[model samples]
Target: MSVHSWPTQSLRIRTMFASKAAEPALWRLLSIVTLLIIALWWLSAPRDLFSAPLSVTEIAREAILLSGVWAYVLLTLAIVVVMRWRWIERPLGGLDRCYRLHKWAGIATGAVVLLHCVLEWLPGGLARARSQPSADASRQLGLDWNAATQEMAELANGTMLCALIAIALLRSIPYRWFRKTHRLSALLYLATTWHALLLLPPQLRFTPLGALIGLSALFGCAAAVVSVTGGVGRRRRVRGTITGLEAHNGILEVECTLAARGLPHRPGQFAYVCFDPAEGPHPFTIAGADPGARKIRFVIKALGDYTGQLANRLAEGQQVTIEGPYGGFDFRGTAREQVWVAGGIGLTPFLARLEYLRWLGRRSPSVTFFYCTRNAATDPYVSRLRTLCTQTGVTLALVDSARQRPLDFDAIAAGLRDPSGAELWFCGPARFGATLQRAWRTTGLPGRRFHREWFEMR
Candidate 1:
């Protein structure tokens, strides 16, 4: 027992460990740490490093102004590159992770960059910098202007614009335009790196710490390029087609079948499907299907920009490109008692799960389902699932929020044979899952009993 006199069960902990989307959070945290280290170093030093006299505040401010703007922009561009690089997103589970890391890294970098601008940049210093004695010692203590410095500064400013554009299109932005502009940012990162290296005077060029940072940026750029070129060891392509399209409950349902490339998949995993080469492919969960079969299918509901068009535009036998089958929702790796939570179209992955179970001719080994939706009017695959539960003896509890309903958590728990050992699976919107998570935790289910899936949402 680590706390509260409750025994710590790693099984539940392990079971509960699901994938997380990396947002722009981590880069911010790292940036804060850098500030702290700078402060401590400044306080302990006998003399300032800048050669000329400048207070800690002024020095910090100037540092921010110089690094703050470009770091965020460059990092954002790098993120675009990384996202573009993950062609083998599904089998290796790289695409999802890449998006997350890039997001978090950008967020982190974005924050730090802003702070560097705010907390560190000396306000309106262009004039003051010009007034400094030209004859003063060639000490690199203050902001200096030169061809190299000017070029780097311009590149940094350009990259910032690139990042802003990237963020704007994070969700609703058309995929093609975003992809092309993001590549420009990648080239800018490379440009900045070269610019930085060239400007480094003999004194700081090869310093161990400086070299390390440079190396990291270099490697990141290379990795980004490789991923884009299928050079980073990602599968070059996933060819598939729209096997069928049907409208269910006023939402369009799309069925896609892929020719297996011996790509490994697990229950709760998803694939990116394309109806037109010009239109960006979207990630849709695999409806329960046979992995061994030459073809596997996905069920998608008309939801947004790409998806809303699915029902009307894509036809049977259209050639499509798929980018992934990425996710950490695989249930086969565990042996814990299971509880699956689904919301709206979130149940698509479980369809595949049930199919897999059927193929093996085995019961889902102690499973319970708690599905939430707006109302029965929009439940995408109710008919198929009802038949499935009846045949498999899988117990289902439906919660419709549109009816102003609260999920019967206690009642659901009451039926669980081993609530403490049950592995809970959840997939839905951010707020819905978070609310359910808190409720489940309050009810004393093991932490592992709640697993949430991360999908792309604006």
Candidate 2:
């Protein structure tokens, strides 16, 4: 796919697979169910001061005994927990995934806040709190304003949720707008946290003592917002400059190094790099990094539009922006044998991975590199890769499509020590990787042993 459509389309498929949208739907359905439950509670609970009708006091009576409100809270917690796994702990290597998941969790949490307000305001609920002896400490301290405080709380919370939804949906909105408005959400969450605590009696502050049930939800939100916004996520940028450029056939490759401390990345992770503000901070994996020497390297091939002009117009040190080191397409988590497949510049991160292995002194694992190109003439890194593989005990397969020759995988495996148990890692066009995966499955190996990273998404 073209770069312009890459992130959006890639994310759509991933989001679908993750079923993050399910959380919002779950919350919405629960909201309707919660309303029904509250209605039931109102019908059953004592209504009068004598009969509280649906006023704040009667609603408070049911709110205290509301069954399964905690279930919706549990649902929200599940989303946050799932997201924390995929984004924070897993080696996803990119922020797009995190951002998407973060949005999902935010919406779910916001929905729960909404339900909390509505459930409590039904007749006997807030009315009871309002009716509590006016001479109580809260009233003595000017806390007699339950009506105004509840509405203020709702306004703050609802507006923050709307801003988050806007940021998540209409991503064409400026990043600065997203950043500023979304920041308000954490502060609003803090406010809502205090609002909940202040309104509830000490005895009802939690479903169970010290669990701080409702309080914990708001805290989780505040923490996530701080983590992402305060540079704990991939919020920092490292500078880089183009040092060399060359065009071979229709392929354009540019060589560059990190101009500063460089970014921390694994062998196969990519960065969302932007040379201009108008375009995307497109993903391009780290093809090479001199970890001990302190510089980042990447090789980009011309795919059209802006890339065609890369060789001629990109000056050395033109100052590029980056949001980085994302994607789980690395072998750090695995120990199996590896088969790395590449199409054109998809070979970028693999080369760096090999270099990293060499520097770290681990005997590089047995590897098979599959290089595909129209011909040897158009392959940008084939010579360098072949030389590196030969030096590092890696088997290299160069597939030239024009020759119309069948690649004898059985024959290729004969040269390898063993093919089974060896992991296959593929990066390149989606179709190319998928095709290779099918072929690998025929080898009678566990499917998980074969891995593919869709570098084309960059």
Candidate 3:
């Protein structure tokens, strides 16, 4: 539709979706962290870092401090993101992307911790064997604290943190175990926070770097507490009952009617649906819902262990906890033409948008929706999508991968009247979107012109 008004509580949908790229917020956050690290290094870095003939022990010590500080900051940041705070999630574009940020931050923290551990002991071991001064000599420069005892404790903590991160990164691990083990990071983070504060140089405790550390620890601890106490996303959660359940091919269509006024959500947004408490909440896009309506729909594909069993486990009238209405994939753009690509179950967001358009009786300038599926005959959505496209005045391009060639960037480009002037919105497999986005940008489309939602939670 031509910039139709959508209801939202905190931010105007029109304004929120006007932005072309979701990654600016992510990049800006990273830049801020980098600058903070640089500023802190300048404030309290060792003289040996700049002096000539820097010893291996000196370099190792410096690496230890730098990596530790980075790990601390990133660990805190990961906790803050996992809190599912709407304000933090909004700028990042969606909760799914926020989880993506969390995933990367955790991995980075793990890598930094590993680096810190290697630098902590490797140089000392070599120094001892070579008859050189022990690495402990560098500790005397500053950051005065218990040396041997704290070092042992830190190594233990670092090892454990690394282990947890490993378990998290391993997708083969059952999601239930992953969920439970992931909570343990909150405790580990608390330990790291304590270690950071306790060992910070006495003179620099009140400096800007210290303040950043302190504020981060404070916020991080708060978020960690929420996570530990099982209070994450509690305020945003609303009760709902399953009103309908259907299966089409391998997809599970879950329809729910809220017990209260529905949580405010924009079209193309998603929520964390808790169908089974034991398994916890998993994110599912709100495939169809009116703003503030009690009724909503989620189209889930059987892609994993937990979701594969949902069709059998879920039933009508069963209560559920929905913690979301998160994401900024609102179908808004500033181009002469808007192109949509949905791969299989990735059609959820676009389906929501089409329904919204039909309900509003609005039509945009020029819109093309490409629904890519294996077979159109067995795909239940094709018939309804065809009707919605007709009602909304949007062109539908069905790409049956089984019958014909796959939908590629060139195919999409061929349909566009002005490739440079059109915006592309894609929600599909990560590899598919990556290939399309690479080609789109290679052809001179601005990076901001392509809006895509990341589907990976881990």
Each model's lDDT = 0.57, 0.57, 0.77
Off by over 4 Å in 3: 1-32, 46-57, 125-156, 159-161, 164-168, 290-293
Best by TM-score: 3
Ordered list by lDDT, greatest first: 3, 1, 2
Candidate 2 stretches greater than 4 Å from native: 1-103, 110-140, 143-145, 156-181, 206-265, 270-284, 291-293, 299-314, 320-329, 341-347, 357-365, 369-391, 396-458
Q: How accurate is candidate 2 locally (lDDT)?
A: 0.57
Q: In candidate 3, what residue range of length 10 has the lowest lDDT sum?
A: 1-10
On a 0 to 100 scale, what is the lDDT of residue 348 in model 1?
77
Better of 1 and 3 by lDDT: 3
TM-score preference between candidates 2 and 3, better one: 3
lDDT agreement of model 1 with the native: 0.57
What's the alpha carbon RMSD for model 2?
8.7
State TM-scores per candidate.
0.73, 0.57, 0.86
Clashes (backbone N, CA, C under 3 Å), per candidate, total 17, 31, 0
| Model 1 alpha-carbon miss at residue 160, Å | 3.1
Q: Look at candidate 3 and tell me the lDDT of residue 294.
A: 78
